[model samples]
Every structure is written in structure tokens, then in C-alpha cells.
Target: MLRTVAVPLLDPTASFELGVLCEVFGIDRTEQGVPAFDYRVCGEHPGRPVRTTSGYAVVADHGFDVLADADLIALPASTNHADHPPQLLEALRAAFDRGAWVMSVCSGAFVLGAAGLLDGRRCTTHWRLTDELAAAYPQAVVEPDVLYVEDGRVLTSAGTAAGIDAALHLVRRELGSGVAATIARRMVVPPQRDGGQRQYVETPVPRCDADTLQPVLAWAVERLHEDLGVERLAREAVLSQRTFARRFRAETGTTPHSWVTGQRVLLARRLLEDTDLSVDEVARRSGLGTAAMLRHHFAAVVGTTPVGYRRTFRQTA
Candidate 1:
């Protein structure tokens, strides 16, 4: 249903953010069975070159007229977060009034705030600019920690690469996980990343003897069906439980328990998407121990129940 995607550009745009939108929505992947979106780059004035933060200028082939019928309108980051064009703001308001999806990357949330779309909605931008965004739009519920937040038809993401996560989430929500996976496979990125993950780590890394935990982590992932408590993992890593805890936090930016739980949830997602296994079986195989436990953790991490997730994302022959 998300067919047409229009991007409205402002001057001094962040090229990487703009490229993220283009990569996710504009690329043609029909050969891989991913439906191509009707992507357009538009501006207030058609055919006029807009300067980018990287000292390059790009021109929009269309104007705001393209946004009138767009299923999705994405705004990319720009250095000039304040003072969006009045016409662009009006177009955004009209699009939202008609129930079209509106998304912003990084500081582009400023444009949405100016159009009154972010008021009273949970949203997020880059962590560095979260305070400024909250102060500027007091009525908006700003979540400074999330990678992205989706409220109603509006979606806002944290800086840079988080745009890919938000965009892929929308694709999966609308088109199905199969289609999203196809696109992600072609892009060589993970098919799905939970939007609730923290955008940045504020705590300093603890000192550890090891440089990385890749081998131990990889070993744990393969044995997710087995008990993966901190004590067991610490034994495998040949370290004291206290040292393993500190080193795990330093190496992975999360506790051993949290990381293992996240991996199990990911395994559960794969099983739900690629198999017709019963929810109880998925729980058992993913080391969740019981259906109730799976449901509880699945809901907490995925925002959906196992049955609901399978119904939504299950691949069919």
C-alpha cells in the first residue's frame, strides 16, 4: 500500500541521510521480487538546485505537487533546522490531515514540529539535539533514547543510520517481512532492528582484558536453545562472573543477560517468520522455556505477540 514516496528537501541537507531514504525507497529491486516504490524528490521550487552540507548541490525534478498523492513523505536532515518554508509546512499538514505517513530523519523533526504534526506525539531525533527539540516543541513527548518512534501515521528517527531502521520497519509493516527481507538482502543490512534500541550509549566503556567478545558471543548464539546464564557464559569465557559482567557491558554495551535475551528473541522472530511452528514450540526452541514467557518477552521487545508476529510476517510458499 505504500507505493509513492516523496522526499521534500531543504537547503544544506545532510547527504548521508538523504541517501538513506533513496537507498531504502528509491532503488528498483523487482528482479529480487521487491516491489519498486514510486520515489520522488521534490521541493518548494521545481528544478532548482539545493545546496547540501557536503558542498554539493542536488536538484529536485518535481515540486510540492508530487506530495499531494504520495503514500509517504520523508524529510531528511538539514543544517538549517529552523525556518522551514511555509509552503512545505502547509503541504505536510495537508498530507497528514489525509492520513498519509510522514517521517523525519534526524533534525528533520523540526520541520514536522513546525507543521504541528509532532505535537502531543511520542517522537525522537538525534540524541545530541534531543534537548533542543524538546525545548523547541514543549508539547511533543520527546523520547531521547529510542532509535525511532512511530505514533499514529508519523515516524521520527534518530541520527543517520537510524533512518534505515525506521524505513525498513515501515516497509515490513506495510509490505510484509518477506519483501522487507528482499530489500534488506540486496542492501546487505539486517532485515529488522527493533526501533526501541538505544540510539547512543552515554556510559563510558569499562576497562577489560579482552579486545572483543566475538568468539564467545558467536558460541552463545549457536546454543541459544541451551541455558545461557551469566554463570555458564562466564565459565565458557574462562572469567569470573563479576569480570564477565563488566567485560560484557564494555564489549557489547549491554549486560550478558540482556544480550542473550535479545538474541533469543531474534531467534524467535526468525522461527515465526520462516516456519509454521506452534508458538509453544517456538518458545521452547528459542530457550524461552514456555509460551507465556515467550509472549511476555516477545511483547516487551517486539511490541507484538508471537502469534500476531507469525500472522504478520510468516513467509508462504
Candidate 2:
């Protein structure tokens, strides 16, 4: 059981993002058989009416002192990008020094960076502010394209909706994929997405033009059992291999080969959790061809063998 303390700085965006953390982590969901987290919203000063950027105020009952015993500390997105409160930074440093997992959503990374927690660590924030973050903290490696970045004890997310992804990932890491998926299903979200994905996916400006690669992607998804090479996909799209490769990368921010591999791994994970399929059958069905091939790429991309991932995440029907 993890005790989470959310330190919401005074601002509209940060307060709302803190509310999201409360909804995801603080609420009791044991009826769904999901483990409940002990969560509380605290402020730098207790019982004070903290103003939000959106012309709202929230009163928090606890102060920075609540952070000492927390298993996790969350800093939500803030409106003020220039500086964070000094006392809050001190409390965050103390919590991290005590070995608590510290996380931030969007510009909340600023708070973590202020505490010197992000130094020498790979982290991310909103793309619009990536340059500022990089300029402000020369010691941190800022990855602008990623949705989130987890560096040991500290985790930082890109922006708004990506905050949910970061929070769910933390649940997946602490609990298991099964529990995380349950929560995500209840929340009507895809259970897992690679943290290195783009924060804002560029959609075609017009809906009609949005059919860019839908047909090809759908065709590829349907044929997960077959080896999907770039030539085959290009043929399906009626384009040359070079054009298809460039278009695919532009559309997905990943190569066709890498995208296919990632999709296969995802399919394999879904099978591991939801079915009683043998590893060999799963490998064949997910397009990796054989169990040995599946094990190799699964370990390379997922950091676990097929059997091990199944053992860790499988849920009995």
C-alpha cells in the first residue's frame, strides 16, 4: 500500500491537475478489486485558501509536514513557471531524501527541478515549455517528444492528459499491469502507452483529410499474425517503400518496423493478460512467428520474457 501526498501549489492548472491525481489515486476502488491508495491533498501552508489561475480557490487541510511519511509525493501542473515556493521545494527534497517516489505533472516538473531532483536525470514537461526547462536546468536532459520520463525515484510527465498516463504508469509499476488495466478500463482509457510517445499527436486539420493512414493502419492491425514488412505495407498504401517509410514516420513519429514491433509486443501483452494461450501460440498470433522470437523482442522491448510477463499480469477469467 502506498501513501501518496499531493502538494498542490497555488494556481488553477496545478489545482485541477491535483484533482485528477485525487480521482485516480485517492479514491477508493476496492469494489473493482483494485487496491486503494492512501492519498491526501496538502499545501505549503495548511487550511489556507489557495487561489487558482482559473479564478477558483481550494482549501487544503494538511501542510508540507504531511510529506515526511508519504510513500509518493505528487506535484501537479502550475501556472507560475518562473519559480516554485521555497518551502515546497524543501519539503520535496526532504521527501526524496527519505526515499519517496516523487512525481510531477506538466509544469510541475519545474517544482521537481527546483528541488534539484531532476539533475542528471532524463525528464520531460509540456512541449511548449521544453526550451525554457532546458534553458533553466542545464544539468537535466529534457526529452521534448516523450509523454513522460521516469528516472529512478523521480517521474515527470509532458502535459494535461499525459498526466493521466503518467499516473496510470505509476500504478502499473507499483501494483501490476492487471490492476492498472482494471483502473484504466473503468476510466475508459487504453491501459498502457509507451512513455516515449509524442505528447500532442498532430491530426489532419480537417476531418476528411484525417483518413491519411487509417486504412493502412487498420489493415496492418488486422494482419498482426503475418510478418508486416515495409514493402508489404507500402504496397497496401499504393506507394513506394521510401515514400511509405517517410509518411509512416511523419504520421507515427516511429519507423514502420519499430511500430509493427511495438504493436506486436502490445498484442502479446494483451494475450498474456486476457487469455490462456500458450506462449508459442501467442507469439504466432502476435506476428513474432515463434516463441523464441517473441521472447527475444519481448525481453528487448518489455524487459521481460513472455512467461514472466504472463505470470506477473495474467488475470483468471
Off by over 4 Å in 2: 12-15, 194-317
Please estimate how well model 1 matches the true structure, expressed as its whole-model Cα lDDT.
0.87
Question: Number of clashes in model 1?
Answer: 0
What is the lDDT, from 0 to 100, of the residue 147 in candidate 2? 78
Per-candidate TM vs. native?
0.65, 0.62
TM-score of 2: 0.62
The 0-to-1 C-alpha lDDT of every candidate, in the order given, reads: 0.87, 0.80
lDDT at residue 100 of model 2 (Cα atoms)? 83
Error of 2 at 212 (Å): 31
| Residue-wise C-alpha lDDT for candidate 1, range 177-215, written one tens digit per residue | 999898888888888764343313332322335656777
Clashes of each: 0, 2
Off by over 4 Å in 1: 194-199, 202-317
Q: Evaluate model 1: give its TM-score.
A: 0.65
Model 2 C-alpha lDDT versus the unseen true structure? 0.80
